[model samples]
Target: MPAADAGGTPDPLRRLTLADLRRRTSMKWRTYEPDVLPLWVAEMDVPLAEPVAEALTEAVRLGDTGYPAGTVYADALRDFARHRWDWDFPASRTALVPDVMLGIVEVLKLVTGPGDAVVVNCPVYPPFYQFVRHLGRRVIEAPLDAAGRLDPAALESAFARATEGGRRAAYLLCSPHNPTGTVHTEDELADVAARAAARGVRVVADEIHAPLVLPGARHVPYLTVPGSETGFALLSASKAWNLAGLKAALAVAGSAAARELAAMPEEVGHGPSHLGVIAHTAALRHATGWLDSLLAGLDRNRRLLGELLTRLLPGVRHRPGEGTFLAWLDCRALGLGDDPAAAFLDRGRVALNSGLPFGTGGAGHVRLNLATSPEILQEAVRRMASAVPDTGRRTREDP
Candidate 1:
């Protein structure tokens, strides 16, 4: 457990140190050399909530590692959604899958056949391309606008091309989008729903980051929109509670699309670990306080990162998006060529995700993870500043 400050508020998350985090066996720590500071992966540097840990521990003690079964996980999600987002999520409309990406692939198979087109917004999650391609589907990209927000015009054009020649197609929506952390506004989502419906495109929303929405931002479920009756959404407690290793997620369908969700094969459910279901259910049902504390800590880290970037890497442009702890940085001014991430990793020993892999509009960019302690974030920025050539000349003078 984390110690408390003078205010009696526990700030355990802030107490996390590089030395302590390095001891873990996770990929984030092991992917790079010992001396390198890894801010690449989406994993956070926070301890598990007590409820989640307890549930996992209890499951282990009872040797409950059999195959996953039942609807407890979906029910918990229902309760949590009702209270947190004011949305009535029907448990009957959901199916359990190993994870969000897999659930999306399964849903896509139901809606479209092999070689059908699947649309994505690039400078988007790299996996959106990988998994869709693995399923033998053609990936059509609708790039985000200059400010990293959804552009309805771009989407409309992509939908037209994707649905041409009477071809079957599906749109993979990443709400509270990855890499850029852009939270889709209600108006924007409604527009998307309307556009997709008009083009005969089925929408599958990846809302794994829905729970991680910070203050001043709202996460509106796509199915809740007026014209989204035919859409499906993939959700999980993994991102918000740092339970990615759990391998559990809910594939939810709109009332009119329930049959598609029900058609998902039973073998898909077998992929989720039994313990993962227990932990995720506990997280959604009994871990709101922990989630709240994490949101507050992330809010601090986001602001602190901006200050660090402004002072240390003035040539790099970053506008903190409305949700998620990922910061998409534009490093074109630094002249790091096509891949700035490589330069940062090679020179600064900071491993960030290369924006090149995210596709068009990704060159000269890097995505930095902002889920660590302020101290670590500060060190990362400092090391990054040192990595750039003529850093002293590029920095902005303090007012």
Candidate 2:
């Protein structure tokens, strides 16, 4: 007997197996083998892009698995940056850091200090809050407005309050926002930049998921906005190509102010992995079509899951996801006790991110990553609908 071969389809969204459709997703971190499905973690089950794998294999075959040094590595990264995002990222300003978290820490070191206040949007990536606290800075939650998108006025208010309190220094921005999946508009980014600049706050934009943006949504590079040069851009190939293990990310600084943020002592002395260099270049050149196919697959899964939730369990409110693969589910109407994460895990046998960690407003919600196959989503939804209490439900309009 032999294992069946799934088509070497570069697209991860379309591949689903009968087993996948039957299993529950797991969100537990302690145990890798969850009895239920495992969708809680951000990692995807897809194999690496063929080109990325080939590049790594070729690098290993040549036995060049040492620390990166010299101009060739920088040139490869520069070329990829120019081609992929259409931005003129100067290779000179780019530093090959080991990972994005390190980049964030370094930026925090430079732009802020103990007793300083760091502004971040609510329901953001958890690390944004952690990074600020780890650096001994106070966190000011400038939560997104009612639309689940950045509200410029709220940001201005937060900035003013921080200034009045004399704790302002840095702001961390997630472009294609996490948890909520709202892609910020150009005007929104500009307003944030203008406000931050006025209050002498430097912005660090984490764009790790920029490459994974869905169709019909434009990704505006933070530096592209006027006065954006006052901010630093943090990006990585980890999320898009699933190369996180290779551990190479870039910190791109446009203006002198931003460059100063990147040149902190804590940021220095880190080395880049040779494999990350090779894979990133291969992905930029050969994986464009693959990325497009994957995005389409993600979009389909998102819609399918939304539709299923609507029909089977009407109270679960979900919008058509705009950017990232994450689906923000409003499970307030289910009324299955207070903790939705625990309820879904225990009763539904589906492990999902608890919405409370995202912020107070995220309470009674759950964040589901739709990056997996359609079959998996179907089963996950099935478990959820089964576990949810039978409260008389209403459609989206009833809310």
Candidate 3:
């Protein structure tokens, strides 16, 4: 077991230093040069939770590398949801999928069709645009409010535009939103459900980040809201438990959407890795303590980032996210043009995610992963601060 922080929670982020993290071969680390401090991707620096690791190890030891069986994964999620957020849904209403994004694609197929408009809150997960367009569906943007909250008017406008010509449309919602980390409040979600219902638009919420909701915020399951019984949700332990590489997720159907979910090809359940299912089940069933510790470390790192930017890189603006270990940065003030991440990587040798890919309102912004050690976070900020041009100013006056 690891030592606990002042909050009496194990600081998972503290367990890995830059040196230790460098050994990682994941996209988060390997995408950049070894000398660069990579903080662009969602992969966390912490080791796997003991329970999850033990489960996978046991599975392999017994040569249980076969297809998944039973509703154990969904049952575990149900227990976690009920305990954590007071939410519940019968296991029969869920379907196993390869992963969240693929699951989203599958669900979208059931709700919308080719040439149909699929609405998304802009500056969202880029994959939303990619997958939707690839499926031959149109991507309609409904930009978020200035503070990164969902905008009712924007949604209404998009919904109206989408349902034009009596076409079926779907709204792909990112609850506990990525990059911004805005956890949708219950009232906000209720409004979304009502508005989406009234507009005849199906809601497909991606709540993969639900379990990672930080302090002072709560995650409202979109399906739990009134008027949302016809919607669908994609949930997974991938983001919360660092199991993205394992690849397994659940597709949940709202009460009225259950039949539509069942219409999904039975073969879809065969896509997820059997081991991935086991790992996710173990995480939800027995890794709550580890998740809590990770939340503590993330909370601390978010605060630390705000302070670092204030002192070291004043030109950059960041609002600490309400959930998840990601931070959206407004680097527009830095005069680095639209893609400040490029500048940071080239000059500072710190690779942060470019804002260009995140869609409207994303330019001049960057998405940073905060799930690393305090030392790496501090070093990354220092490198970013050094990357800014001085404009021929004297000591302490430069960026």
Among the numbered candidates, top lDDT falls to 3
Error of 3 at 115 (Å): 0.3
lDDT of 2 by residue, 285-384 (tens): 7776667777777877877887888788788878765787788888888886446878888888888888887865778888897888777788888888
Write one digit per residue (lDDT tens) for candidate 1, span 160-215: 99999999999999998998998998899999999999999999999999998888
Judged by lDDT against the true structure, how good is candidate 3?
0.91
TM-score of each: 0.96, 0.89, 0.97
Local error of candidate 2 at 144, Å? Answer: 0.8
| Candidate 1, residue 116: how far the Cα is off, in Å | 0.9
lDDT of 3 by residue, 1-399 (tens): 555755676788877767777777889878877898899888888989999999999999999999998999999999999999899999999999999999999999998889999999989999999999999999999999998999999999999999999999999999989879999999999999998988899999999999999889999899888899999999999988899899899999999999999999999999999999999999999989899889988898899998898878777767889998899999887878999999999999999999999999999999999988888899999999888876411233454
Ranking by TM-score: 3, 1, 2
Clashing pairs in 3: none
Q: lDDT of model 3 at residue 141?
A: 96
Supply the TM-score for candidate 2.
0.89
Clashes (N, CA, C under 3 Å) per candidate: 0, 7, 0
